[model samples]
Target chain A: MKEGRETTGGIEYVVGAEKGIREIVRDEDVMPLLESALSAGASRVEVTDSRGGTLWACGASSGNNDSATVERRPVFLEGEPAGSLVVEASPGSQLRLNDLAGLLCAALNKIITNSLKRMLTTEIHTSVVNRTYEELLETNKRLRASESRYRELAENLDRKVQERTEELKRMHTRLIQQEKAASIGLLAAGVAHEINNPIGFISSNLNTLKRYISRFTEMMDFYRAAIEEADKAGGGITEAACRKWSDLKLDFIVRDVEELISQSLDGAERVRKIVSDLKGFSHVDDSKEDIVDLNTEIERTFNVLVHEIPEDAEIVKEFGSLPGFLCNPAMICQVFLNIILNSLQARRQGLKLHVSTKHVDGNITVAFSDNGPGIPEEVRNRIFEPFFTTKDVGAGTGLGLTVTLDIVTAYGGDIEVTSCPGKGTTFVIRLPAERREHVKVR
Target chain B: MIEFDRTEKRMVLKLVFYGPALSGKTTNLLRLHDLLSREGRGELMVLDTRDDRTIFFDLLPFFLVTPGGLKIKVKVYTVPGQVKHDATRKAVLQRADGVAFIADSRVSEVANNYSSFENLEKNLAFVGIDIERIPLVIQFNKRDLSDIVPEADIERVWRPTGIPVFMASALEGWGVVETFSRLVELTYDSIDGKCGLSEGYGLDREDFVGRLTKRVQGS
Candidate 1:
């Protein structure tokens, strides 16, 4: 198939079936060339493809003429036969037929080679471009998948972090609850003693009253016996009955019995009042948030801590008419109790705690000022941190301020501490008077 | 890493040429294909774009037979040097026994070379191949071009890394074989140390090198 027609080199190359004589050889190109060949004395001329299909034809006779001389030259495309040209010689014509056929063959080969080159380059370009486009599509799909995966991971991590933080907050609240229970347990011992003193006096008075009642009953029995004896003797008084009445001292017993009964009733009333105070101060159902007076809860907390306060300690109250705000009553009481207890612990003698409440700028601020040895500057900053304490381990769980801060902030309130060494300390708590939507259980 | 089949008495190894775009990675392979004896190697397979630029990869395979009849086959590959062809480069670098980093020697390409080298290090780590432990050789290609960096400057900066460096004009076929030979030796030693190829399998070092590096006729 190497016809030595390709312009690059002598190497052989195969042309595809797609490149046919019909596509390359147009009628305009072949007709003029063939007409000139015939005028130069060739009688007939015909062009056919590789498969011998006629592309262009001009014949002198319809059938094959055996008298005419024929010259056939195969046209080559990319060093392969693509078509052929046939010229029949006319008789007695002075034309160089060999030179004419040679020129026509060379012209046809050049055109086919040129067309083949263009077609091959175009095919390679389109195919390569198509493959690259497909690869790019696949790459884009993979990148999208990867991006979604990363986004999913990030979102999952965020959820996990939130869950962990919520769990920690719950654990923190439980710790505070346990600390409050421990403090209550400590206060209960003191409360029992306070109630027991009145109970003891009431029990003693009841025993004395029992003896007085028996004395009165014995005097009545003697009087009844004397009356019976007199009736039997026809309404005459007996001397033995009269002597017993005189020896028993009935007049003094009557006066002492009335006094005993009155004293017993007074002691019983004292015991009842003490028990009622204990019940009111430790209201266990005061867990849920409700609209309550801050001053009232503070007074109840003061009552609960009465037994623990030193004998000469003075508690001063400056009350303002604050509107009821949403709060957990027990938690608010615990907050006041913790501050008072700390004030009591800081000073053993001549301690004064001034508690005040005010409504200003739509907020209620409760302040507790103590004239005890205030917190030093170095230890003041870490007071709200959990497990930070200056007291002995058994005396403090160190979560008092921490719990106070947590509960206050949960109700959308904030606490500020002002202290100076050896002077006084004040804890001011500011709370919004209205219930907020984001209030949480601490 | 390469596969050594004891049952079949055959070993297969791979070497990859890696560098930035148009930095002579394919040129190095083409030069080796021209210089090496045809009996020792297979045909070079190039997957190129319409403009004759390599878009995927090129492969040239070579074989060697030790004196003790242990057959060894080595496949040399060139990854597409374009930045976007990272996936193809990683695929070709898999299980490669050695790497020849072909850097451009022109002054303007110095930054590109360094960045590509950094990319190589990052990709090696991502593929779980320790760049510190892998057998590697650096080749400054296109040395015959004008405005190239001085050999002294390259050596001064690279000597501290302790990797062997060579300057090559891949278009002219000079220094190509030397770079190839050094990488082959390094690969052989690493494989030998890992699998006891020399002690247990009776593989001779010089015999393996000689079989692959023999010159072709009239080259």
Candidate 2:
């Protein structure tokens, strides 16, 4: 119970510490009992506090304040010792003052208890009322705030619509970009297919041309030997053919032609490899999930992304042998591309992205670790949220990690990211070694 | 510090016990009441709710006018730790001189403890109390229960806070008095340093704490 509430100016609820005993035990309330006990053949009656501070007494120093004739008992308020009753019996009194003292103590305690209960009830009721009033005030404040917000919204309704319209426009642009990307993939696949046909025939023609050139060289040698034989017989026709061949510079021409054809063959081979990489990227977009050697799929994805990688960037690979896994290779490649590109863009130079693969516990785990400025604490968890980019507007759509998460989760896999703000970030992706449906029931 | 009457030389200091709901805050107060009442100290005034929880606040007050003509009154209060009592908690937390955060010792209540601690920090700031300057202690209650957090692990996590941490079961009444005494001492020291209690009124730290903690009759 709080005590001693003074009307301190500008203070609402200031109180002293002790809920004093005198407030509950007044003289008017206990004087009648004291006088009655004095008439009940008792020589003396008294009431005092726990500290022996007297509140009421109808007794003299009878029995010489003797311990033998005196009876004392503590009074209580709400189960706490608040005061006491001390009754002294003169030697001539026939009544036991101890019994009288007990009765007085109980009576006094009851009065104090009832009074304390009322006080507590009042205090609690007041607290409840104050709490309700405060609550109403809070509610009013909130209502006013929301009403003002609504008014503001109404005043700027057109601006609000325009803002939403701008958002819709950006969404439409993203939709078109996604459609264009898919179409480009299909078109690139078509181009690769078209180029593959010409490359096959050109390669065959170059082989045939090589064989013919060799045969012509052998024929020229045979003719040169016959011409020599003719010269030995002093034939004018053979001598004229030798002079025309020398004038044509046939020796240098033959050597140069062979080298030129070999170089063209090498260039054609490189073109074919590039087309193959393009096919890996594009042709798989529309295909069903392939039973892919995971390592080979990783190699194809990296080969397609080779141009984007910096020339001096160190990429360490720790690829473990893994079993064939079922996944859409194109979608998986997108995940790889997004992660690797994030690593590349994380720093200006000396980027070291460590990619590792391992098979353990029926899952093939791939981890991409980057030596770059890592994600800050505040932004780490939200990095995968769609449209939650830290990059400048139009610089990033922020859908990369979201899409990667979708692809990995769709394959019944999960991704984990661990990063130190100043050191680096690591993204570990785990996909099942085999499709869930293919697992043996036994 | 709640109030100071310069003319009367009276200083009222308030200490609050706060924690998550069912984290043994009121139990600690009850233990204090039980142990302290036996020593003829003040009765524990529990403003108990109908649900048997703290709604407003539980108060146990110590009033003393020292031999040196200075009145130092200490009020120990426990706020309702339930989530819905935010306003009440904030109100009771205002002008608190010290705080003892009673954390649950169960291994499962780590998140609740963390959120409650954050709430304490935020509410302290809301009440215009500087958290760094105020005296604060952490007590992990319910150490008697099974599946409680290991002491070593708790220390490892809370050691860097630089606040004194205690392990106790209020049910057994082991560490309640120690927590109470420490809070009182710290509160006294803080007020003494700032308000010049010693130089102004000859207030002694040991004397003040001894008078306030006189109710802890060892069970």
Candidate 3:
């Protein structure tokens, strides 16, 4: 890769000694040396100077013979010019005194040129090495900066990954808790209905037994009055009291007792109807899909939680005429139960829970709202996040809204919450009106 | 390592004045332009500027003819001292035979001086001029300013480099000629070796120096 060339020229050096010689000798010496050598027909000339014991020589010769031999000898500087040289002559040789001077000039020029070349080459080589070293230093600096940047990016990435992993762990824990709470809700609804059934019949049987005791007591009172009148009439009246008791139809009274028992049996049948209605309200069978009435589920959740709400709180329901929705009835019911219970818990005092359902835009929109201290601005955005709750730590698990959101999303629905700090909070849940075939499998 | 030809026997030597921002590179050129004999030198040509600042460069051309008929023309150039004008600096440094680095001597400017020196080295390489091969002289300028950097520290740093160093206040016109003379001597020796000016052209070193010095002082 030869790229370019560099050339230089200038005046740089001085020859000949001027210190111990007269100015005229120093100036006149070179001219005579040239003239004497030319007059000798040698076609060449030489000069030597010895000052401060330093040997300096100038020599010149001319020749045309390609292989001409020339003598080589040492030149000495003294009172007289002393230097040795040989000249070769042949036909057509263009050798002259002036030519000798030119040749000497050329030889001396070679010496100076060679010396300068060595110096410039050395300098150029050193400069190139220095430049290369400086470039290497710059490159090394850039590489170190790049390495540090990559290290910082890697550290930031690792920290972000760790934060995301922790978030995933919390979500997993919330999912487990939601599943447990859903199961518990199903159990409570079923047990409440089961206990209602036995109590209904036992109360009805006790009421029938009281009515029979009253009728038998009236008949005994009539017999006691007739026996007292006969005893007052005389000694022979005992037979008349016995006849009066017979006339009062004691046999008929025994037949009437059997009729009373039959009536009590009818009343017990009415009690059975009430118990069956209670069972219908609490559907506990956990299956993939079930046809459920939205209105009925809302009513049942309200009934179950009515006693738990504060006394000052009011519950309002606005139910629409909606067709039965095919869904995972247990899960849907659990979602309603959790939301309503959460509303009750959020109430401070004088709370109002308004639950409204409507069919609109091919979906059933169930809106549950409460008038209480609404969710604060800071925590409102995170209401559906697991473990984010305003309730006291042990009293509420904070998974209620999170589970509600998950169930709604799983059903291809959405739930939105709106709250104003001093006003109230409202949650709107939208579920698909028509069940899709794919939803039944999962 | 940069080269030019003188086909007409009139060779021009290029010397560059380079340094950090506000280090008086332009001031040195101005002083030389003002003091040198007008008859022996061309008019100082300053390439356009912005707000009296040398944005490109300043040039002062001079001519010296030896008794033996060798004509030597020396061109002195001063690069813009602003750090961002590196392209201009590099352009001016091309074919440079010698350099004078005008460093700022204020105590706060020590780092700037080093950075500028490094920049000079880079620019020189870009122009294909080997920094070590080209005769280099360090000129610490702005000595008139109080709180100047310590002289000992500057000497200690530059001594090992083996290049001539001089303290100057270009504003006061002190030590400027000494700095210029040192570069001239180095430049002459370097170019002489290459051209065989003394042996081939019969141009002696004393005659050349005497003429250059007389031209510089006669202005």
- List model 1 lDDT by residue over A93-135, tens digit each: 5666677788877776666555544554454445445545656
Instruction: Give the per-residue lDDT digits (tens) of candidate 3, residues A342-409.
Output: 77767757889898999987899999988867888898789889778777766667777777787788
B78: Cα error in model 1, Å: 14
* Per-model fnat list: 0.00, 0.00, 0.00
Which 10-residue span in candidate 1 chain A carries the lowest summed lDDT? A7-16
lDDT: which is higher, 1 or 2? 1
Candidate 3: residue B13 lDDT (0-100): 68
Measured on C-alpha atoms, candidate 2 has an lDDT of 0.76
- lDDT tens digits, residues B1-219, model 2? 777776767677889999998898889988888776343345677764757877777777676666668766677888888887765677667778999999999989999999999999988886677899899999999999999999999999989978889998999988988888888788888988977777888878887787777764445
| Residue pairs that clash (backbone atoms under 3 angstroms), model 2 | none
Q: Which stretches of candidate 2 lie above 4 Å from their native place?
A: A1-11, A14-19, A22-95, A106-114, A158-442, B2-12, B33-40, B47-52, B62-73, B87-91, B125-128, B194-203, B211-219
Ranking by lDDT: 1, 2, 3
Report the lDDT tens digits of candidate 2 across residue range A1-442.
1224432211234222335567755678788988888888777787777778877788676647777688888876544465678888888678877788888877877777666656655654565467667768888999999999999988799788999998976775465346336434544654565566657756776775676577567657767777788879866765666675675566666786676677667668767777777667655345567777767766776776665567888999989999888776666777776787788778758989899999999999999999899999998999988778877776566777877786788788899999998799999999988767542110
Candidate 1 ranges beyond 4 A from true positions: A1-119, A206-272, A434-438, B1-105, B110-146, B150-219
Q: What DockQ was computed for model 2?
A: 0.03
Give lDDT per model, in order: 0.77, 0.76, 0.66
Instruction: Sort the predicted structures by TM-score, highest score first.
Output: 1, 2, 3
